[model samples]
Target: MQVTLKNFTKTFDDTTVIDSMNLAVNDGEMLALLGPSGCGKSTTLFAICGIHRINGGQILFGDRDVSDVPSQKRNVGVVFQNYALYPHLTVFENIAFPLSVRGDSKPDIEREVRAIAALTHIEELLARRPAQLSGGQQQRVALARALVRKPDVLLLDEPLANLDAKLRLEMRSEIRRIQLETGITAILVTHDQVEAMSMCDRIAIMNKGEILQIATPTDMYRAPVNKFVAGFLGNPPIVMLEGRTSGDGRFLVKEGTSLPLPARLAGMPGDTPLSLGVRPEHFGAAGANRVEGTISFVEPQGRETLFDVTLDDGVVLRSIQPARDDVVFGQKVVWPLDAEKLLAFDVSGRAV
Candidate 1:
């Protein structure tokens, strides 16, 4: 199913939660709404599922208008964050609850529940109650229940948030596999960048009730439209160095630090304030642009280590590289910055 929102607006009392937003989720494609808390990710999901009445705009499921449809009549399935399950009901009974509510026959419900259980790899846990299963197992039961009805659109509300780190990694692949095998249109709402980047086909980055940018993970990472988009997508976050354009075709970092400006950015009006954004991986040992700094902070990340290098003028650049005993904290070292990979933003935070 293809889901679309045109001028999708929502309000709570007087404040608008979703401002005249427009987005199209392709047919059978998984899209994620990623942002910080209270960014309207959940509000948008509920509106699409008919749980919240929008203050304005329209929502369509393919060619049908579902804006006025009731929650139960939309034929959409939602797997919530907490994996809402009945403690008293057995796994089989929980999976069959939705079917039972619709008054389906005993045989029909049995076949559907068993088939979904097998798909979710939970057939063995059918006789057990929610309290008897692990977090991952309970999650599978929730997914099974949602899929048993063969819903047109499957909504996942941070479905992996309750699990441990290992389980979250395990279920990421599991959910992706099940979604592909079933070919159902899925919308995932998450604040975790790793979850959104790894699990979905495309991500719509939301902030303060507006869609900032929507693109594939690679595209968004390579070229963000603004400072916020560039800074929001990466882990450890993209480092933004404040600077200004100089007359000698260079960028002057605050207080006596300078870098040669690429020809493309050399003519952007003298003294124009600029921000240079560089991802952690882009700072390395060899490149055309170099800066000398001291390793001030060290964070060991298994095979790779994160180091904060405080350069001349006190500019700090975070670099992630292979584990090395050669570089110790407070030691001076010169690192290179990939000129072509650097991101430039103007005063308004718009990409230059």
Candidate 2:
């Protein structure tokens, strides 16, 4: 099933939350709605599942318009962040509950429940109640329950937020594998970039209740449509410094640093105010564009070290390198910038 929101609008009291948004989820693909808190991601999810009513426009399931359908009538299943489960019910009962509601025969219900239990690798856990099972097991039960109904669409809202680090990683792969095997069109609402990047086929970046951009993770990261999308997508983040094009074809940072302008920006007019951005990983040891800075901070991440490079003008930028002791705190060093990978944004925050 392909879910779509067309010119959808929603409001609360005097404020408009979602404003004339149009989006489509490809059939049998996992799509993620990624953004920071209060960005209307949850609101959009609720509107699709019918928890929140739309103020205008339409919601569609493939070619059929489901705009006026009630929540119960829509053939969609939701797996919530908390993994809503019945505490008193055993795993078998929990996974079987959905089919029971639809009046399936006892033999059919038992067969289906056991089948889903095997698929989720929770056959042994069928006898345990929610409280007796691990978080991962409970999650599987919730997923099995959602899938048992054979919903046209599956909605997951921060489904892995409750797990520990290792379990989260494990479940990310598990959910993605199950999604592929089932071929169900699913929507995931999450703020975690890794979860979105690792799990979804494409990501829809949202902010201020509007769909900013939608594309595969690689494309969105390599070529963000705007400054906000670029900044929001990376870990350790891209270092953005205010700069302007000098008549001599150089990017002059306001903090008294200058570098050769990228070849792609050669035709840009001089004195154009630009926001220069470079990822931490792009700063290296060999490039014509270089900056000398004192190491003010060194953070030892397992396999990589994140160094805070402070320039003479007191501006700080982060650089990532393999963990080594060649440079320490307060040591002066020169790091080259990969000018080709530097991104420039205009005053309006649009990429140049």
lDDT, each prediction = 0.91, 0.91
- Candidates in order, TM-scores: namely 0.98, 0.97
lDDT of 2 at 109: 98
List where candidate 1 sits over 4 angstroms from the true fold.
none
- lDDT of prediction 2: 0.91
Candidate 1, residues 166-278, lDDT tens digits: the string is: 99999999999999999999999999999999999999999998999999989988988999889898988999989898877788888678877767777777898999887
Number of clashes in every candidate structure? 0, 0
Model 1 lDDT, full chain set? 0.91
